[model samples]
Target: MIKLRASRRGDGAALFDVWYRAIVGSHDFLKPDDLATIVEMVQRDYFPSTQFTVAVDDADRPVGFIEVDGDSIGALFVDPDMQGRGVARALIAATMPTDRAWTVEVNEANSRARRFYEQLGCVLVGRRETDDLGLHYPLLRLEHSAAAV
Candidate 1:
């Protein structure tokens, strides 16, 4: 079974491993330098600032995580080994608020992620030429209704 728990400071490294697995598997278009930059931002900025909910496996090993900031989901990533096992869905469902809408920015190039969010009832609201941290990647801004997961 998958379980959700509040992330502790010590979970950073393990969560980073999950991030690396997820990103490296999905964002194959990223160059080494771009990946490096993302790694730095995930470690230095995103991980510490957002409230994280970790999805753990039966043994209590984290397999995925979702980062929530205010009413937005800043990031969600699952280990490649744990993909297609509802880890992402569980992570989103665990942290998503039901009283108000929340937003997420999916990389335009990542159609799989876009589709996943869309299926979860997120609708495209806008677009951007760069990612959230000003990286040079196209982004599709999406909003999830409070009524949907």
Candidate 2:
């Protein structure tokens, strides 16, 4: 059975691979240069600093991950090959605390991600003109209420 667990020291590369493939498949609006820069940051900073809630397969290999830090979901990415099979949904359901609302930011151009989150009961609460990196890609901030989960 797939289970959720904390990410370990050596999980950086594998998570980066999953993150990269997912981005490539979903984030077409990102400029090549911007994507490369974001990739560097994710590999160097995100993977090391955050304790990701990793969804592991039967053999305990990470098939997907969600970085839910406090009230904000900083990241969520499933292996592109593993999409559409409830991995993303399971990650959110398993890790999100039910007592409080949670937030996430999605690229405005990424319709698929927006739809996914919306389907999961996340509603748009805000928007930004640029991404966290100060790039031109806009962001839509979504929140999942505690009562809905």
Which candidate gets the maximum lDDT versus the true structure? 2
lDDT tens digits, residue span 2-96, model 2: 78888998888888888888999999888889988998888877778878889888988888999877888888999988899889889888888
Worst 10 residues of 1 by lDDT: 42-51
Residue-level lDDT tens digits of model 1 in 1-149: 99999998788888889988888888998878988988888789877776688999888888999888888887899999989999898887777788889999989999999999999899999999997667788999999988874
Q: Which stretches of model 1 miss by more than 4 angstroms?
A: 48-50, 147-149
> What is the Cα-based lDDT of residue 63 in candidate 2?
87
Residue 119 in model 1: shift from native, Å? 0.6
Pairs of residues clashing in candidate 1: none
**Looking at candidate 1, what is the lDDT of residue 147?**
81
Q: Cα lDDT for residue 45, model 2?
A: 79
Assess each prediction's global lDDT (C-alpha) against the native: 0.87, 0.89
Quote each prediction's TM-score. 0.90, 0.94
